[model samples]
Target: MQQDAVIIGGGFAGLSAAYILARARRHVTIIDSGTPRNRFAAHSHGVLALDGKSGLEILADARAQLAAYPTVTFLNGEAHAAQGTIDDFHVDVAGHEPITTRRLLLSGGIEDRLPDIPGLTERWGKTVLHCPYCHGYEIGGGPIGVLSTQPMSAHQAAVVADWGDVTLFTNGMPEPDEETLALLERRKVSLQPGTVDVIEAGTCDRLRVRLKNGRTFDVKALFVAADLHRRGTIAESLGCTLTETPAGMIIATDTVKATSVAGVYAAGDNARAFGNITLVSADGVMAGLGMHQSLMFSGHS
Candidate 1:
């Protein structure tokens, strides 16, 4: 099959891009595996006007709205490999047929690498979350715990302290410097210096954090500094340059979402220095517009 643009991934970024491109009269096909990084998340927050809606609910609403546009199609498959060049990109979807497009938008997003502790993975996006902006308000002004799994976890703890009574669980990590320690002390954030054994659901949907010392802490929520990985392998195989930053390793993109490779654009967590639901959606919109403009200038749109 052939189209004007092929968007890989079906999260907020891919859907938003498809919506915009379809509205602009472009024949766009979104290839998605239907497993967004936020699938584990119960609700999406920090999105303007839709702050506290479930991730599935928001996507369903978006899909219903985009259904009005006839130029758009959704394929529930993964784009395994992409070849060819600008104005003629060929994408291969695993277990399906290949497709050709004039341009490509990758909104593949990323996955959070949670700690090895038991129950953390199962509780991810529910009791265990990452971004304070996204899940903090829902758990506002309660006993919140931050699991220090990365070097920057102390900073995360400091940030979450603004919302509620905070506790920093070192989880075997070294103590922070005097400056960092002072900051925590000044903020009245408690410190737990031991490895976490497990996290289990407690009374009233709270989380019970069990440390190695057999001590337990009942928290309204827990924030973990999880390592993130790009959701798709196609980008790396296609020669897209990945860069490491304080936030994490992500695909490098310019102001317009153009990647290191021409004819390819990246959006969402894959391209963002800081990943958030609202920001990812906005980035997708911008990348869609940029891709559209590129196509128009080249006389393909």
Candidate 2:
């Protein structure tokens, strides 16, 4: 028997899509690795009514709401490979039975690789973060630090300047050109050079950044850019085109969320560059509708 849809992730996007499809009387299966990109964040901000809720808390609520729908199935494992075609696809998932579905939705999400700086990874999603809109307000008016990893970091520092006293660290990257320097100086943002050697926690939520040049600075928090990539190969294995964006690369999809391959849809970070809770959830909704519309008219086409 074939499911009406098999969503290859059960994060906010995948779960939201399943709810829509299940409500439409379609049998939906959500295959997730049970680990999401934001799992490391103690709490997520700027996320609608759920703002400030722990990542785990938000997911628990989503899963609980989805439980009422008997048509939606969940498998806690990773998807291995995919074969066959639209309206008759075979999917292999490790440690789970194989699946057949009329439509496939890839919401497998993405991974963020921060620099291997000592203690940097441990502080990420806590004292270290990105996106002022998502986390800046919570930080309030305090000392904030921006670690430069890319050429555009000065721009990032200027943006984060509104949150607090901003310090831009070149961190072994290029010194800010005169143009960028003038802007940060105008904003009263401090600039530091040399690579970040270590990050250490201090009392009262303060962070200490040490440089190879033997310079040290303390601030309430630090921000570093991370490279984002698709978490798995299911999308590429099934032949979804990839595209680059300002934030990161994403799986390419049409407006309705259909990929280049028929009956295959993509949502969440896998399909779009900029994403948050509200945005990615809507991405899944579009994929759900796209899948349904295609199946509804398949008899005639």
| C-alpha lDDT (0 to 100) for residue 63 of candidate 2 | 88
TM-score of each: 0.94, 0.94
Q: What is the lDDT of candidate 2?
A: 0.85
Q: lDDT tens string, model 1, 1-301?
A: 5798999988888888888899899999988887888889877777788877888889888888887898988888888889888888889998878899988988884788888999899888887988898888888688999999877889899999988999999999999899999988988889999999999987877899999899999999999978778755778877888889666788888888888888899999888867777788889999988988998899645
Q: Please give the distance, in angstroms, between residue 129's alpha carbon in candidate 1 and its true position after superposition.
A: 1.6
The residue ranges of model 1 lying beyond 4 angstroms of the native Cα positions read 203-205, 299-301
Q: Tens digits of per-residue lDDT for model 2 on 1-301?
A: 6899999888888987888898898998888888898888888887877888987788888888887888888788988788778889988998777999989998975788888889898888888997787788888778899988777778999999999999998877878889888998999998877888999886677899888888888888898777777766777788878898766788899988999888899999878877787899899888888888898899933
The most accurate candidate by lDDT is 1
Report lDDT (Cα) of residue 152, candidate 2: 75
lDDT of each: 0.86, 0.85
